[model samples]
Target: METCLCPLTRSFRPDFVLIRQHAFGMAENEDFRHLVIGMQYAGLPSVNSLESIYNFCDKPWVFAQMVTIFKTLGGEKFPLIEQTYYPNHREMVGGRLGL
Candidate 1:
C-alpha cells in the first residue's frame, strides 16, 4: 500500500502503523519522518521503532554508542568516551568553509 510521503496527512486509517524505513532528506520522505514521529507521539504503534530508525540516522552517535558497547563487552580499558564534548551544534552550521 503506497502512500504520499509529504505534508503529513491523516487521511489513512490503519489497524496499526508500521513506519519502518524512511530517508531523512529524500524527496519521498523529506517531511514524512516528522509525521511518523508525530503519529508515534499521538498514540500510533510503529515497527522498526523511532529509536532504531534514529540510530542509523546519526552516524557519529552510532559510532559513539557502538564503541562504548564494544569497550564494555570486550573489557578494553581504553577511553571509549571522552568527557569533553562540543556543545555548539548550531555554531558549526555556517556558510564559511569550516569543513
Candidate 2:
C-alpha cells in the first residue's frame, strides 16, 4: 500500500479517484472503521497520523511495523489475507449454543 502510494501520489498528485480506489481496497473489512476512529481520536496530524499512532504505542507500532514491512516487501508478494475467524466469534458461538 505504501509503495503503491509513493509512486501513485508522485505521478498523480494524490488524485482522489486513485486514492479512493486504494483506500477502498484497504478498508474492505468492517473492523477498519475502528482503526480509523482510533487514529482520529489519537489527535495526530492527518498525513502522518498512522506513523504517529505507531510511535505512540507498542502494539500499534508492531502493527505499523508489520504493515511497513509488508509494503516494503511489496503488497503483491505478501498480499493481505482475510481472517477466517470473526471478531465476534465467541459471542456467536455462545448464542448458537444458547449459553
Candidate 3:
C-alpha cells in the first residue's frame, strides 16, 4: 500500500495546539501542509498558525534577516567572510529548469 504524504484521518482531536516548529523547511512537504489543514478543519487554536509558518517559509528574505539578527545577537563572528548568506537561488532554479 502506498503511504499518503498527508494523512488527515486522525483518531483523536485536541482542544489546544502549540506549534513550535524550529525549521520552516519542514513545511515544504505536502504532508505537513495537510496536517496543518486538518488542524484548521478541526477548529483548533494553534500558537503559531500554519499560515504564519508558511508565510515565513515562503519569504526568501526572512533567512537573510535571521542571519543579520544572529550576528547582531552574538551568534558568531567570522573573519574574511560575508556576514550574511544570500544564495543564488535563481541560478539554482535555472540549472534545474535548464533555462
Candidate 4:
C-alpha cells in the first residue's frame, strides 16, 4: 500500500492503474473500490473500476454478459468449453489421464 502511495505523491504518477485484488466480500470490495476511487481522484485511469468490479462480483449473470461480448467481438467461432472432474479411473491410467 505504501509502495502504491509513494509514486502517487511523487512527481511521477501512473497514467493508468490496474487493480487485481481478489475481493470477496463487501469490506474487501469496498477497500478495493476506495483504492480505485483514490486513483481516479488523483487524475488517473483505472482498469476494472469500482463500479465494474462491483457489477462483476455481485451480478450473477456477468458471465453471460462476457459471453455476449465475446461473441460480439468475433469469438462466436470459438470452441465450446468442457469441464471434467478428477480421479476418474476410466479416464486415468498409470497416473495419466487419457487426453
Candidate 5:
C-alpha cells in the first residue's frame, strides 16, 4: 500500500526525513507542477496541513521542514501575526485549506 505523507509521520525519525526528502525532491523536479496537481487530485492539499500543526506545536524538525517547503514553493518570508484579529489568519487559512 502507498503511505500517506502527513505531519503525524514526523514522530518516526527515519520516515520523517524520508518524507521530507521526497517532498523536497518533488519540489525540485521539472515535473513538480504535474506532481503537485496529481497530489491535489489524490486529495492532498496544495500546502501540507501537517506542517502547520507542527508549527503550532513548536516541533523543530517539522517547523524546519515547513520553512523549507514554503521557501521551495516560492514563499520567501514567514507569515506574521496581526494583533487586530482574534484568531490568527495564517493558521485559519492553513487549517481551512488543509494546508
Candidate 6:
C-alpha cells in the first residue's frame, strides 16, 4: 500500500489512466482512493472520473440518482425499480425479517 504513494514515471509516462475492478465494501480500498487522489493531483485523466469512482461505494445513492434521471424520461414502460433493502445479519438473527 505504501509503495503506490506515487508512480515512478521514469520508465513510462501514461497519457491516461483507467481504474476499475476495485470493488466496493472494502475498507482497504480507502488507501486506493488516496492513490486515485494522487493521480488526480498529477492531472492524469481517467475514463471513469474520480467522483464517479467514489460514488460507486454507495449503491442506494446510485439507485436514487438513477431513479431521478429515469423520472425525467416519462413513459408507460419506463424501467421501474422497486428498491428492497436487506436486513443485516443481526436483524435477521433477531427475527426482524420473516424471509
TM-score (C-alpha) between model 5 and the true structure: 0.20
Minimum summed lDDT over a 10-residue window in model 3 is located at 78-87
> Could you tell me the lDDT of residue 44 within candidate 2?
34
- The model with the greater lDDT, 1 or 4, is 1
Error of 1 at 97 (Å): 19
Assess the local accuracy of residue 65 in candidate 2 as a C-alpha lDDT between 0 and 100.
59
Model 1 is weakest, by summed lDDT over 10 consecutive residues, at 90-99
RMSD, candidate 6, Å: 7.6
Better of 1 and 3 by TM-score: 1
- For model 4 the TM-score comes to 0.35
lDDT of 5 by residue, 1-99 (tens): 999886663332122221232323323452333444444456554344444433333334455566566767654466622222223578555544323
Best prediction by lDDT: 6
**Whole-model Cα lDDT of every candidate shown, in order:** 0.58, 0.43, 0.58, 0.54, 0.42, 0.66
Tens digits of per-residue lDDT, candidate 2, 1-99, equal 344545443322221111111112234462333454554565434544454433444333345556676778877887654223223678556544210
**Regions of model 1 farther than 4 Å from truth:** 1-10, 25-31, 75-99
Query: Per-residue lDDT of 1-99 in model 1, one digit per residue for the tens?
Result: 898778965676665665545536546646555665666677766655766664566556666676677667763644454432333665456433221
All models, RMSD in angstroms:
9.2, 18.4, 9.6, 11.7, 16.8, 7.6
Displacement of the residue 81 alpha carbon in candidate 2, Å: 5.9
Candidate 2, poorest ten consecutive residues by summed lDDT: 15-24
User: For each candidate, how many residue pairs have backbone atoms clashing (under 3 Å)?
Assistant: 0, 0, 0, 0, 2, 0
Residue 27 in candidate 1 has what lDDT?
A: 61
Q: Looking at model 6, which ten-residue stretch has the lowest summed lDDT?
A: 90-99
How does candidate 2 fare on TM-score?
0.22
* Total clashing pairs in model 6: 0
- The local lDDT score (0 to 100) that residue 52 gets in candidate 4 is 70
TM-score per candidate, in order? 0.49, 0.22, 0.41, 0.35, 0.20, 0.55
Q: lDDT of model 5 at residue 71?
A: 62
Any idea what lDDT model 4 has?
Answer: 0.54
